[model samples]
Target chain A: MNGLSLTDLTWAVPLPVVIPLAAAGLALVLWRNARAQGVISVVALSLVLVTSVALLVAADDGPLVLDIGSWAAPVGIDLVADRLSTLMLTVSSAVTLCVLLYSLAQGLADNNAETPVAIFHPTYLVLTAGVANAFLTGDLFNLFVGFEMLLVASYVLITLGGTGERIRAGTIYIVVSLLSSMLFLLAVALVYAATGTVNMAQLAVRLQQIDPDVAFALQLLLLLAFGIKAAVFPLFAWLPDSYPTAPAPVTAVFAGLLTKVGVYAIIRTQTLLFPDGRADDLLMWVALATMLVGILGAVAQNDVKRMISFTLVSHIGYMVFGIALSTEAGLSAAIFYVAHHITVQTTLFLVVGLMERRGGSTSLDALGGLARIAPLLAVMFFLPAMNLAGIPPLSGFLGKAGLIQAGAEVGTPLAYTLVAGGIVTSLLTLYAIVKAWNKAFWQPAPEEPREVALPRGMVGSAAALVVAGVALTVVAGPLYDYTERAAATLRDREQYVTAVLPGGRGEGRSADVTDEARREGGTDRVEEGSDLEDVGPRGGEQPAPPEEETGSDEGTDEGGTP
Target chain B: MIDTSPSLALVVVAAALTAVGVYLLLERSLTRVLLGVIFLSNAVNVVLLVSGGRAGGAPIVDYTDEDSMSDPLPQALILTAIVITLGMTAFLLAMAYRSWQLNQHDEVQDDLEDRRVAQRAARDEAAYLSDDDGTTTLEQEAAEVHDETGDDGPPSSGPGTPPSSAPGSHAVPTPEGGDAR
Candidate 1:
């Protein structure tokens, strides 16, 4: 294997998953001390961030795979880190760290009881570990495990204080997510039973050899599982209901991470295992519907949090549109869109939380005159709101520009429909944001008022996110390049396959043996007669091989070809 | 004996649960709605389980025959689903209890119409008072002010009541026949 020792393989792969998981365990043990848990959690996440960066640097040209305990091929547990996964890990870790800090500040300012504060750190650490695991895992079943880890942590974080509103929202969130997880599991089982393998690389190799009809069924099942998680079209009703009810930091992290995981899985599955672009036509239409329906929901909401939540649903359509196209540019655009949306959407939600705090309520009727009293808050809210609406000089605009450009490249009637949907959704999002601004800030205060104060830490956290949103906009060019690289890597599986299985090239050469060894061992092998009986003739002299060798190779190959 | 397939039976059960859940969700009682959510979650779980296909054999490692292994992926997935549902159920129960305690009732009503009516009445009262110019008669003004303030002061000048100084003082309605007047 490329003359590498076991030490290099062991150190390279497991750090990203292990650091946060170990920290989670440690956090749980120290759960009684809130401050200690917070410190430990932050340090753990920071380490994850460093490891993700290191992984990206180390895997510059190809993916990295680790088989746990040195087990070979399909039998072992594997962790794979491709460009897309590394990028996701980096972004997730960064966003999670910011949210963790925000939560700590919020807990201190609100003087939340000790128990809930203590629970927050451990759960947050687990959630981080889950996100890392989901991105890094090479097995379908392992992905499911990662998803469950994150979902459970999110449930607790969402319902931590157990207020009536939070509990209600958390209930809906948990039920919907649970349903999706079950679907994912069923899909994995079906695939495993059909193929007898779950390793993504091996599955990619084997699935292409299966029957067309069976492959189609497997593809559909996988789509449904990821679709439910991603909140595409008919599957998205629970998002708006549950997301807005949580604390601002929790909602921010959810907005940033949860749905994006679904998108990541979809990208991986579609690009790697199933490259039939036509199969995604159904998804394109569903993407359009998701965009239209979500924005309409946003238009109907009076609560600030719920409106943002609905808008989150609407923006998911943009990413789906990119995936549906199944082209290099399309995938690149989708990746860029995901990164931009995570920052913009999370910032907007956090700002909404700030608005709620300053105005004494999230309801439009209870809020007004915020601009007169809190211009900084208004500016923070205004920037992300405008960005989310795809205003110029913002990351949101650049992401949409890339998507529309990709849509135009496809040059189909359906493509036009998606473009139209994108435009309409953007307009509706603007309308929603403006409605919130007018009612929450620009209008005069109500006749009778509840006195409200904006906490310094809350403002600070929001400011940090707003700056991040702006930075994304400013660095759009570089970000696009990075995403394009990731997209290219996804489109060309050769680099990935070779990276995982060294010596994948050169047929007839033992993959585990070096060229030097082959040269030295050549003398011993020359004495063995060449078996020509198994080698079939190509309109030339007949080549022969033993019956066993000929029969097994053709048999397995025939069964494998879909 | 019934000849239905297990997959079909699972589908039927899911449908029934979903219908019941939807019906309960429409009810005004919060507790009923919570129960409805629980049923709906169970229905979704059943749907997931059925989607894996009919039961086959156990998915144990080292099994030689492929057909003998039932899909283990669904079981693993359902385990997580069960845990998530438990968390949700607990949260819903807590929320329902809290709502009951706060309102002393378990029902949630659509309050938009009632609130609208109250707003309209308040606006009408304000408009009625503001219609006249500054030259309101003393007795009429006093009566209007008393209505606005929800006071029950004396109807005429007496030991406890101040005498009206304006020329239209007699216009004030007497307490005994105020509505008749």
Candidate 2:
């Protein structure tokens, strides 16, 4: 155990998640001094950004698994940094750092005594921690903890000012989020009940042995939980209702990052845990509906914020579309789109915040002439807006084109329908952005605009993201390679299981297994990809008598809730 | 694996609580909704506990045997979830109370814009389809036409009309222009 040099970089895996959590605690302690909080946030998030990059690089070398307190998988909490997780951690951490800068700038500029500005710094840090943790955790229970941390932080951030509207929105947000979280808990419990372990790779090994009907039921339950959080069609009513009411920076980060986490979880669980593609057909149809319905919602909105919120929901469909294809190109496109969407969406929101400062309202009915007054702001808005709408030479377009190519590769009726929906959604997203543009920037100001000072920090942070969005296009070749590798890793789940749980069962899954060996047991538990000996068809079934067993006592030793 | 009294009672109680909570959640009053959330979270906690299987002896055991001890993981998860739910419920309660203070009642308000958008999508295809500019006038006209026809989905009918007949107007349900009011 001491001689194992392969696990060297495992210690660095959770730094991005940990540093921010520590910073959050520090910021909370120093709550009175906003300046100290700002310094702590920037320095901590910058470090996180650096660590994530390192983690991603190290993961590319090989998946790095860190068992909490040196306890191994299926027992201790695991933090794994495979290509998929590390990539998400890297992009999102970078995004969070930039958003933090923007928020700090906004707070300093206002000098508002009434708002809980100090609390913002800590809560925002906590939110970033939650996001990073979600991207990094190796087990279901830890993943749930990560989500709760991030979401609770978001609840505070969402209702920061405690305004009537903000509070009302917060109520809806918490209620919906709680519902989803509860469902996720139920899924976790059931998974544990069925399989006796919540380690994802262990589930992969054991689940295939379970009855296909029960396995599919579990898959649907998990999908339903993630689906609500991801804001898919018919479950997206909560989003358009609540998002527009928050402060600009809060709204920006929320719009940019939060839903993507859900999408990330969906991508992770669907690929890693349930790899048989049972839900692919259902996901494809939902992708079409979500794209159409979300964009139409955007097009109908008169407020810029609301429009973007709907457009955000609409664009999530593109990612889901890429995911549902369950192919290498498709998953890679989905990953690329997720990264691209995060930057572009956040940039758009930051730009919207700028418009609010200049025009005093995000309502299209109240805004105009920004093109003449703040051409830079208009540029910031236009670039990401066009990118979001998937114009040529932009990252959004490139991502969409990849997904479309993948869909065309499938050439099935549902695939074709999704392609059409993709095209139409992109067009409508463009239309919605343009509508907001025509009203908020191009036309004459409806009333005299407020002469407000645009904070350099807010604009600068926003511009940095805008530049990053453009940079994504400039570096699309390399980025696509990264996402491709990530997606390839996702498709070949065996390597991930092997890397994370080497000596554990569920290893050597990719090797060819003979038909005779699979049918040897004559029970339904033969999972073809896995090593035949590791998990027999009924190898790790729950004891049913969970008591009196110290073997799997990890779940039994509950402690340290803060 | 089979029925145990405590676990069975817990499941039954959780089910009953969730049903009641969901019913109140669907109501118009924010305060009642908060109560529903409270009940629902408590029920979820009960389920979390029951999910660990039937109650057993303490988790700690000698080397000889600890197999009958209750699972500690679900309890931990329940603790964490309960703490979070309590905090969130408090936040919701505060919001509901704030809304009550701001207005005279704690009635949960519908998001008028979302309602308007949905109604327009169903009844007035012209308004829903023809908007890249999001021209309020075009939508207003289509909505009026929709009202005149009183279409299958919903119309911009008068205040006294049923929800299906007047969802578009019922969102604001005021003399105010569209949902912007």
Candidate 3:
């Protein structure tokens, strides 16, 4: 699209995942040198930011595909940098970088008392790598691997100090996460068994030919797995308990990135592999429930961190709402909301970290008169808090407006109910936030306040995120356009499928195996517009298109084996 | 075409593993929870094995004919999964040990907020009213939650008690009581 070939841009696709992984190894090796680890992580994430932005710009023209080690699609894992992924990647890298800077400042300010400095850098880098991997991977198995990488890193980060409360929270968090991972693994297994391959692009082409019932089962399994991870309604019990116990930076990043990765997976699988929208109504109800239930929990919380955690679960409903609509407009708004929420939510948590520092507690009753003491902290807290509440003229309002508009266009009774529920969720969010604001800032201090020097580094990083949230509003027009384009490409799955499997096959050396299978099976499917890539006779390891491809019978009869 | 159906034996074993795993999962002890996780992941691994179609010779280039060789992908996935599960197992064990060290028991504790809500519900009290009137003091709220070991009664209960004067200087309210479980 640009002067540079998409091939040239393709190299940037893997860099987002590879850079942090390589840096993680380096940081781990330099574990003794905290400063060195910090620098390595910073430089690595900055490079990821650069690469992701480049990919975001380039991907607007078309999806950028990278067959890992040149093994080709269906046969090997691939990384695709399409509009949706690159947009997510850019936003996530930005958020991670800011959170890293914030934590680095906290580490310096606390003199390394809060975070286990050596372990923190390496784990944080790995977490970023995992997020990048999840966003970029085009293979279902690799997606699971990406999820595991991030989840494991998170398990470590969440329980950093192994304190009593942290350990307790981490236990629930880890067990719930492990269960979800198992479910996801089971889903992957079933999807593979049903479709004969895990490469998403190939599965996109092949899954359509399978029995509808089996396909529906596979879809439900995937949704269940992702639902738990996303903290969707009914499966969100672990999140509020576990999230609040972590240190501020860890909580901020986890809140920002982890569930979104789950949302991202749901989006990819729903739109690409199963475009029929069979689960739309079910997802809609889940969305409504997540929103109302989550917000109600937030309203009932006495603690700031726990309140925010509940809000995080609640807001996930909004994204699910978009996905349920199964329309381009719905998808675009969901993407926009994701980007906005990451920045706003992370900023809120970081600001609350500052509050914890100044006020000496996260409890609403214990904290008072912060407006009189630290006006700067008050402003920092207020802006993102209101943004999170979706007040008008902010990016939150824009995203919500887009969703409401999209819902009206659908005009279904259920869609209208969700629209009403969404508005109610927004109002309740504002109520909870304002109540928090009054208690923390406006209420008279219960006692004479002592001066606690707010760390410049922490405040500065938090401020940067706040500004980034506002920047999203300033650039809402262009950002909305980008999301629209992303939604378009996502809805039209062919753009992604073709990019991954060019010439009706991946650009791998395995073409010979495919040719051999075609000859041996005596199927002239190569003449059928070359739409189907015959699963090679090598144990039917790849997917052969169902129904239309006659060669699959011979391929499978001879190749059926573990 | 592909004999995608799993064998009866594998299916039975997987089902049994899942049932046991789920049972263990519901146990209060962290070790049992870890075991549950291990069993459940193993069950999923077996399912992955089943997903590969049927057993055959090693899939290496020279060891077996291409058609006769097993689907190497699922096995590869299984290997990866096993390794990940192992790492998670180690982490969980360390966490369990830490829990044991901290509380001298590794039971998964109920959420503190849940305890508060339950207490409020038991009293037929409104959380909104308690929060609004400042009648239920922070100490009272903390004392009601007995997540860890050690028994103590509430310091003072009921309305119009002045809020703690040194709220900022107070330690995190450590409200310990006998195991609620």
Best by lDDT: 3
Ranking by DockQ: 3, 2, 1
Model 2, span B106-143: residue lDDT tens: 66555545555556567655322232334455335434
RMSD of 2: 9.0
Candidate 1 lDDT tens digits, B1-181: 1101124445557779979987886666667876876777677666555434445445656753465445455556567667766775675565566545433444542222122223435555321122122313322333333211113332222111110111111243222122111
Give residue B116's lDDT in candidate 1 (0 to 100). 29
Instruction: Rank the candidate models, highest lDDT first.
Output: 3, 2, 1
Give the worst 10-residue stretch by lDDT in candidate 3 chain A: A531-540
TM-score of chain B of 2: 0.61
Q: Which stretches of candidate 2 lie over 4 Å from their true place?
A: A1-7, A502-562, B1-9, B115-181
**Error at B83, model 1, angstroms:** 7.8
Q: Top model by DockQ, which number? A: 3
What is the alpha-carbon RMSD of candidate 3 to the true structure?
A: 6.5
lDDT of 1 by residue, A1-562 (tens): 2445442333566776788788888988876677888789879888888888777766655666766665543455678877788888877787887777777777777754312666677788888888888998888878888888888788877766544344445556665675566567656755654454567876676566556556677788788878877888899877876777577888899998999999999999999889876477898998999999999877766567778888888899999999999989999999999988888888887888777767766756556788988899999999999999999889898888899999999989999889989999999999989988887787776643555666676778778888988998888898888889999999998776554443443222233443443443344222211211111111011112333354344334424532
Backbone clash tally (model 3): 1
Worst 10 residues of 2 chain B by lDDT: B172-181
Per-residue accuracy of model 3 over A1-562 as CA lDDT, tens digit each: 3334554587678998889999999988887787898899999999999989989888887787776776656566889888999999999999999999999988887753336777888889999999999999999999999999999999989877555667777889999999999999998988887667788987897777666667788889899999999999999999999898788999999999999999999999999999999999999999999999999999888778889999999999999999999999999999999999999999998899888888877777777899999999999999999999999989999999999999999999999999999999999999999989998898876665678897787888899999999999999999999999999999998878877764543333345654453363234222321322232221123233442243344345435533
Per-candidate TM-score against the hidden true structure: 0.73, 0.84, 0.89
